[model samples]
Target: MNPILDAFWYILPAYFANSSPVVLGGGTPIDMGKKWRDGRRIFGDGKTWRGFFGGLAVGTSIGVVQHLILPSYYGSLRIAVEVAFLLSLGTLIGDLIGSFIKRRLNLPRGYPAVGLDQWGFLISALCFAYPVRTIPTGEVLFLLVVTPIIHWLANVFAYKMKWKSVPW
Candidate 1:
């Protein structure tokens, strides 16, 4: 597959794998805020054990897949587990940090940060992987800028299709 197209295709799945945990229902910010608050605990009623575990599962799975598919780009199989761990943990951590910021700002959950949430985890994942493997700073900035636009557009269309409850 063409490299650009391949990256484009993978972008959404990667974003989803990272951000899908914060679901919005009834298209209401308050409901999402409640859910978000409940989700803050180690295990609680909001984010849910399911969503946390699911995010970890999906994030790591994608890392493993990336390792397997592009060993050259990632690293040896031996490092794959470590890479997956970093990606999963870092992705979640990014969201957690974002949630913290949102809370401090009283933004409310499901309120949407425009593109920040969509791009935050991706940037965090890449940065977390930096010690293990290096990527150009330019590339990092590219993802920060480009991924959100792609994510925003995708969410808009998905909401229009009723696949998603809100468009951010």
Candidate 2:
């Protein structure tokens, strides 16, 4: 497969995981309204349990579908589940970490931090998935180049759809 296409296909779970949060997130914040010593919200109101779990479910479901439809594309069902779980979990964790940093820096929730907001989940997903599934260097590089643009566009679309308060 073409490197770009391969990377796009391989990273679908991460993509869905990163985006599902916005559509499904709400209610209690992950930090449970806690604050840091700096008097800032640990992860702000943006990070929530619903979002994290919802993203995981959606991403994993998609991966399972992909595996069932094209077994050769991403290896066995077991591997697919592993990839989905790790990528989805990693994406949310990375986003939470980003939010923590943002709060520490006194940046408000929904504020854009350039590459951090765009690439954090992808980087984290890659870190988690790499141990179980070896991704090609070329595909990794291609994803790195492509994902941010897609992230930006998705955020913009979400903003326009009123799902998000701001567009990055």
Query: For model 1, which pairs clash?
Result: 39-47
**Model 2 over residues 1-168: C-alpha lDDT tens digits?**
777777877889989999999999998899999999989899989999999899999988988988998899877899999988888888888888889999999998898898888889899989988888857998888888888899999989999999998887
- Candidate 1's C-alpha runs over 4 A off are 1-16, 22-46, 157-163
Error of 2 at 14 (Å): 0.6
Backbone-clash count (model 2)? 0
| Range of the 10 consecutive residues with the lowest summed lDDT in candidate 2 | 1-10
User: Candidate 2 at residue 127, lDDT?
Assistant: 92
Quick one: best lDDT, which candidate?
2
Q: Enumerate clash totals for all models, in the order shown.
A: 1, 0
TM-scores for all predictions: 0.69, 0.96
- Quick one: RMSD of model 1? 5.6
For candidate 1, give the lDDT: 0.60
Candidate topping TM-score: 2
